[model samples]
Target: MRRTFKWGFIGVMVLIVGLFLDYTLPQHDVVRITDTYNRVTPLGSLNRLFYASPDAGTKPGTAAPDIRFIAAVRPNGKVIVYRNEDTGWIWPPFFKFNSSNLQAEASAMKSTADAPRWVMVTNYGWRIPFLSTYPNAIGIRAVSGPDVKVFPWLNIFILVVLALIVVFFWRMWVRFRERTLDPLIAGGQERWDRTEARAENAAADVKSWWRRIIRRGR
Candidate 1:
């Protein structure tokens, strides 16, 4: 009964630990829009600067035009203007743009019937910064240069948790084997019982033989 209870408790603990590992050890790109804006107007070839391939070329509301504009609408009402620099427009180097403004701008653009409709720009569903590199990086969290950091601490955390789980299970197995199974196997009660029985039989045979000899002599 004790063994069964201990094993059952161990199994439950293992399952709980496994669940925690599965839940806390994975990294996902959590896309959260901070603000919403009226429109997103790209600066310079901001489309070419930020997005590439399929996203490059057309500006919202203009077809076959030389330059295009891009923007993002955030959850809260705000706007991020991404003007096409090739259109001969020079934008200020510094601006106060947030996620909410970009979101609102995207919503407004989508509602209007422009040639190139404005839509939320996402890659694999995460809201990325405007530029792939820095200096001209437009998005809220985007750094100005190509030196954005990828967090390794998350990976390190997962490794530590996994190591702890392995150690815990290993310790449990060692305790069960040494404290329970080892003593039971080495105590030798069966061998001692057999030796005592053999000695008693031998003593009885010797006494019986002696009695027979005495009777014969008499």
Candidate 2:
């Protein structure tokens, strides 16, 4: 039972970590830019987390924000729409404040089905139609073709550094346990043993005195 519980806990932890990495890590998609446009879309509470905040100059509590979108078709004829917004000083740490410029770039690269201009889009997020959420496009560039390979060297380096950091902290924690925590725990056990011994001795002396008093009376 204990072994099953331990394995279950480890599986849960691994799943959580895998999902976190999948959501945060940058991914590349080679698609043909079909259209680029802006729309005044209202953000609901459920889907608002996927979108970026309004520009820094916008007033707070603004309703029905205008968001830019870039629509593209993958090589396999799958449609993927990306919301181009400025992730200004927020999560994912992209620091992308040039949404307007990116929109212009995407517009220039737009192509039709006959002569599709395959472009590589670097983005991080998931598109959930149920929640009305779209992936946030970080940057876009023209590629040779849809079959062009994209090596995620940045993601590889990031994962390596993260692994090293985890290893370093794990080693540090083990060293701390050996150097500080282990001795303190041993010392506590020794003190507890001494206290128990003293308690037993006092109880034995009291019983012996009571028996002597009873014998003398007899």
Candidate 3:
């Protein structure tokens, strides 16, 4: 039972971390830009976490708002839609304020199915059809073709820095417990042991005194 609980707790932490990274880290998709347009997308409780802030690119006081979208076709003939919106100076900190400009660029790069012009779309987030949430595109660029190698040096560096930070704090915590908390615990145990010894000795002395009194009376 304890083992099961331990594994379950670790699994939960892993899942949370995975979702966080998947939402924050930028992913590159090579696809043909089919079209770009704006639509009034309705926000809901279930998928609100995946979209931009309520005030950003929103209808200014309504549940539904107009958002820019980039519709593209992958090399394998798969459709991928992206939401272009401002990150608005928070959270992942993309700080994008040019959703319209991005839409214009996407429109300019729109291509046909026969002779496809491949482009790389840089985005972050997941496409959940059930929740009507799409990946938010931050940037896009024209590529030579669909087969391009984009090495993620930025992601690698960010992950390395985060790992270092975790290690530094973890080591600091371990040293603190060993040097400060552990000694205090040991001292407390010693004091308790001394108190018990004194109590036993006092009881023994009281019993001897009582025996002496009994003998004298007899």
Best by lDDT: 2
* Candidate 3 residue pairs in backbone clash: none
CA lDDT of every candidate: 0.43, 0.91, 0.90
Ranking by TM-score: 2, 3, 1
Residue-wise C-alpha lDDT for candidate 1, range 28-98, written one tens digit per residue: 22122222323233445543433221222334554332323344333333443342222112222123233
Q: What is the lDDT of residue 190 in candidate 2?
A: 100
TM-scores for every predicted model: 0.26, 0.86, 0.84
Model 1's alpha-carbon lDDT is: 0.43
* Global fold similarity of model 1 (TM-score): 0.26
TM-score of 3: 0.84
Which candidate, 1 or 2, would have the higher TM-score against the true structure? 2
Q: Which 10-residue span in candidate 2 carries the lowest summed lDDT?
A: 54-63
lDDT of 3 at 46: 96
Candidate 2 vs candidate 3: which has greater lDDT? Answer: 2
